[model samples]
Target: MIILMGIRDDEQVQRLISLDSKSSLADVVTICRSYEAAKCATSAIRAPPDQLRAVSAYKKGKKNKGHEKNLSTKPSPTTATFCKCCAKQHEPIACPATQSICTSCGRQGHWARTVQCPANQAQCLFCGHVGHYDKCCKTKKKDGRQSGSSGNSSAPNNNKHQDTRINSCRHLGSAAPTATKTPQPLNVLVSYGEATFHLLMLPDTGADVTVIGKRHLEILGIPQSSLQPPACTTTLTADGSTMAPALGIFKATLNLGKRSCPARILVHEGVQTPLLSYGHYKAIWL
Candidate 1:
């Protein structure tokens, strides 16, 4: 005589009632609630097998199998002879005839030549060429061979062709060497609040403002919040006219090796050049 009320699955409920008519309806309801809770707990405890298979399949698809194969099969570039002074990828311009000391190693008897380090089998760090070490690489050497200077017809004709090729490489500009002077070190004095400090000055014409190192900032007692503009600005260096942005300005005192001077500070996230710029030089003059 037990009646199960409000059961959605009437057939299952009826079957249960029929099996145990002596049981109270409340007891049936409790059994049903317990069954539902057990089913939910089982589901929460374990993921479906199909879901695990799908995740494995996705991971397999994302793997770079082809790239790995290509990397394993590819050959590395051939090592070239490197110059130590110019760090160029060619024969040393300073031959034995010149008898120049290696600008890189500062050793006697050999002229600037490819970075072939007789002492080390390892490649030159500067030029990535085998047969030389970084101390023997001269990749930075300027080209002294003048095309028109030879006064030979072949030389002039070759120069014209080279100029044409260079011009074509640029979209709207003529071909010209954009070389800049190398950077040199200068002395600087930094003051944070009442504390005075000394540091190496690196002038960067590429920089619109001056910068102070993190250690200098801390020593000067300048708070981070005191800096203006919250973010750095982009700038270039006089050497090679390299471009970079600066973070912002800070209030600090700068002394060029000789005397202490009041100056505005520009902060940068990283060091690019060791050169000093006109802004810094002018500050020194003042």
Candidate 2:
């Protein structure tokens, strides 16, 4: 693991050792810090202007900060207008839903705007594009004449099975998706007390709350006793996991280049990195 642009460091070496458990630290360091690997990493991170668009979020453009915020603002559907999308008696823009809700599949985050709504259908990632998915997906007989296989492969027939993964799929024909992942240590600094730590933060568009990792709190030497009482909140993690017994929540001033704001963050154990969710994004705009 190159720390930066394929540059090898002690931190990356230790990380490798932890992963393999059996590998010698010196050997792991040698492979990751090879000159060829360093060259490749340097080029990848130093890509030309056009390629940088893929990493647009990291760019600090010359536009006035206020102007930049306006450019990125997604003017929500009118708040006063009832949401025809969800058939909910609420304005679309003000909808606080962090997950996609649709009657068709009864799943999260999948919108109704797809070319075809996949509800109560089986789609084989293997072959039969989509029909109604279960333990086994066989093509239904569209034509009466069949050579080898045909069956009534539609409808929810597995109701007898208490827990099937089908309902977990966010859409019909699609498998349950893992959480969105982000690269760590974002090289972004979080200033607290008088020291600044290069903290890792994932930007989650779907999350309404911002969270700080327990490891970060420990490293910063903040005693859990000092934190407020629990808010009876539980957080869903990206890796299909949950962070429970919310340690506490508090307001802290966060600083980025030329921008600073107070952020309310939920504290939870077992987090690998801090999450910069909607609240954090909104704070930067302020």
List the candidates' TM-scores in order. 0.31, 0.34
Cα lDDT computed for each candidate against the true fold: 0.54, 0.54
The regions of model 2 sitting more than 4 angstroms off are: 1-169, 172-198, 239-241
Candidate 2 colliding pairs: 100-109, 121-132, 122-131, 122-132, 122-133, 123-130
Write one digit per residue (lDDT tens) for candidate 2, span 121-159. 322332223333222333223222232222333234434
lDDT of 1 by residue, 1-286 (tens): 6555676766556657666557786877778888778868878559788877888888887676767888899998766665553455654554442455654455665444444323233333233343433445454231123434444568668778678544543421211123223345666666667777666776543344666555555555667677777354345543336454555576666676575556666666665433334455545632
Stretches off by above 4 angstroms in model 1 are: 1-183, 213-216, 219-221, 230-246, 257-261, 272-276
Quote model 2's TM-score: 0.34
